[model samples]
Target: MRTHFCGELNKKNLDQDVTLCGWVNRRRDHGGVIFLDIRDKKGLAQVVINPETIDTFKLAETIRNEFVLKITGKVIARDNEMINNKISTGEIEVLANHIEILNASKPIPFQLDSMETSEEVRLKYRYLDLRREEMQKRLRLRSKVTHFMRDFMDKNDFLDIETPFLTKATPEGARDYLVPSRTHEGGFFALPQSPQLFKQLLMMSGFERYYQIVKCFRDEDLRADRQPEFTQLDVETSFMNEDEITSLMENMIRGLFKDLGDIDLPNEFPTITYHNAIKLYGVDRPDMRIPLQMVDVNEIMEKVEFKVFSGPANSENGRVAALKVPGGASISRKQIDDYTKFVSIYGAKGLAYIKINDDGPSSPIIKFLGDEVTQKVIDLTGAKTGDIIFFGADKSKIVNEALGSLREKLGNDLKLFNKEWAPIWVVDFPMFDEADDGTFNAIHHPFTAPSVSTEALLDNPGKSLSRAYDLVINGSEVGGGSIRIHQSDMQKTVLKLLGIGDEEAREKFGFLLDALDYGCPPHGGIAFGLDRLVMTLSKTESIRDVIAFPKTQTAACLLTDAPSSVSKSQLKELNIKVTLPTKN
Candidate 1:
């Protein structure tokens, strides 16, 4: 409908006649002349209808903000003082000769350029919200990211194959979104949490390498970075070990960051084990940007007179760890008390601290710890004159989680981050995590291949390690994968370890087991949360900003009023009967 985009006209188009069809961003009147700023998907262009263009100027006077209009004009240079330095097409303006109000709009709920709009109002009118330049650039960058991924995978000889959206439900550490089977009574198909099993099956089907930009669903509670439905860049390949796969994927990520933001990643990403990451940083996905580490002081505190330290120090499942915050003597008492409450979220009974003042180590617990053990702690943590050591003495789990997370918090609070981009691979995860009930649960998934054989894993599940790896950038876990068990017997062994018996395994994953028997190759792959990745790259705090029509925190669509109830007739047609429990 137009010869040139609103943003496409600059000095190069001066004196050339052009037509633009867009929404009028604003209408201004200076005496008899009318100025209209027209906007399209590209951007905005100022159009002036002076008194000389009598009919056009008359129509332009009736234009308002958001009025859709088709304008025929000649691009002309703006006065030196009138030029806008902020916009790309600021060097010139268009002099309108003809103007047509294609569509008129009522007063908008809120101005698009205003930043004071609430999230609820913005989401309710998301179409208008997306018209803002920020949203346009974000979604456009998302498209470019996906396109680059496809091109990279294709060049690597990876097939862009697809997997099913509806499949059998299996335990993937999250509740499945189940779809009722209208034709088959009570039967249901669960939306995939990830194309995990099917992608593994594809490897057994002899596709050497594969990748898919697929949608995934999980019936989990929502968070800032989570939604009911999200997109994943799923990948699987045969004959490639974790090293080969991670290396290639790392290259793709490096190229992506460099291409999109001109940000150069490190030449090589560092690697850490799951055990060490938890010990040092308290989380499996550690944020390496933080220049902090938790130190063990259990051995030194074991014989201390203070039972608070010695009690947990001597126990099998307890720990006494110290987080040394360099130059931390500056922290006020109220801040320390605030931190005490912060760690309580992870089950910490209390937070103990000693300030290394010029006078000597000082703390309320120092008297109970005695001069000897207190001095030893100072020496153990390499406490300097201005350093402050925070202690966590509780069950090992509680201590690690509290202290580890606190270290990251302090890093941010103290502005101790050493770099902006820190990528690392966390590998050598345990095959299973032991439950208090003496049961075994796969750390990643039941299908993840253990570094040890089935017999060794059965003999000692805790000692067994998986060939799994996770890609962490900044603080977010962007992608994770593991080698799959190619042997049917091994697959059955792991499933049985997970309490899924032969019958149950066959029922839930019979197709995958059958494929394994036909000859599966040693395979491994990773899946990246595409939204989380874009959120990371865009430096946006919320995932909703990266999504077009995201749900609210409660997972309801404000724009469409989705998750709405169906009519009784439609339910009857699906052979379903409605039942409701009486409200309390």
Candidate 2:
């Protein structure tokens, strides 16, 4: 319908005849002349019609915002004083010789540029929402990101492969979205949480390098960065060890951020052990941008008479830690109370603080903790005048979560960050985590190979570490992976430790076990959460902002009205009966 995009015209094309197709962005009447700003996917262009062109001018007067138009015009330079410096076609405008209205739009539900539009309304009218400049730009950048990744993988000799979406169900932490089979009564196919086993099988099938920009599903609770179904840049390779794989992936991220985001991410990301990450920052995905860190005060608090601090300090699973915020003595009592309420969300009873005022350390709890212990804390945390030391005394997990989360909050609120961008590699994760009942759960997944051998892992499962690594950027776990067990025996041994009996193991993962027996290579790989990656790059808090169409937090698609009921005949064909549950 047009010879050129509305945005593609400029001073270089001045005096040339052009036909453009787009929606009317804005319409105005300037004296006797009519002006319309037309917008397309590329951008907007201003079109002018003079009284001299009586027919076109009259047509322009009828055009309103969002009316689709096809215009044939002569590109002419705008008077230099009249140029709009804000837009791409600001220096020039189209002098309309002819105009055609393709479609007319009624008043929109909300203005395209309105910032106060509710998410519910925006998502419901996602088509109109996508027409906005920000949404179009985000989706376009998302396409470029995927293309860059595909190009990088291809250049690195990674085969872009596909895996089955409808695969067998197996325990992989999250619940699966099941699809019923018509041919076999009661049979179901589960949507993949990932192509975990299938990718491993490909290694056994001898595709040394493989990658896929694939979809994965998980029937789990949603978050700002989670959805029922999500995209990942799935990757796997054989022969290469942890360092080789991590370095290559790091380079990809570094280059992507530098080129696409215009941010110079760290050339060599710092490495931290899983244990140290928890000890220092409380979370596995630590935001190193935050200068705040947790200090172990367990030793100093152990002998104190204050039961709140000493009791947990002496317990095996307990901890007493401090976070020193520089120049935070200015913090008000009300703000401290607010922080106390915040920490309580993580199971902390309260937040304790010692402010280094002009005179000396001051706090109501100062009397309970004697001068000696208080002085030690002041020295350990290097608390000077104008500093405040916040304390968390509870079970280690509670202490870590409360203080760790508080640290990040304070970093943002108090502006304590040392830098804008921080990326790190969290390595040496435990092979398994111990439950309260002394049972074991895979730290990453069942297939993750331990850094130690089968005999060694069996002897000390709690102490065993995995050859796992996670790529964390600014506190988000963008990607994670671990070496896979190549030998069938090792896989079985690890599975047994998790209380999966022999028969159940055979029933659930017999195919994987059977495949492993047939020459599975020593391989490892990571899957990058593409939505979360884009969310970070786009500087958006919610992954949905970057995703074209995302479900709500309740996992419902309001636009499509999905998860709807099936017809009786359809259900009968599948040999299924509806069973509505009774409300409590």
> Candidate 1 lDDT, tens digit per residue, 242-317?
8899999999999999999898999888999999998888889899998778888999988888898899999998
Q: Against the true structure, whose lDDT is highest?
A: 2
Candidates' lDDT values, in order? Answer: 0.91, 0.93
Give the least accurate 10-residue stretch of model 1, judged by summed lDDT: 54-63
Worst ten in a row by lDDT for model 2: 55-64
lDDT of 1: 0.91
Model number with the top TM-score: 2
The true-versus-predicted C-alpha distance at residue 283 of model 1, in Å, is 0.5
Write out the backbone clash pairs for model 1: none
TM-score of each: 0.95, 0.98
Residue pairs with colliding backbones in model 2 are none
Model 2, 226-327: lDDT tens digits are 999999999999999999999999999998898798999877989999999999999999999998889999999989999999999999999999999999
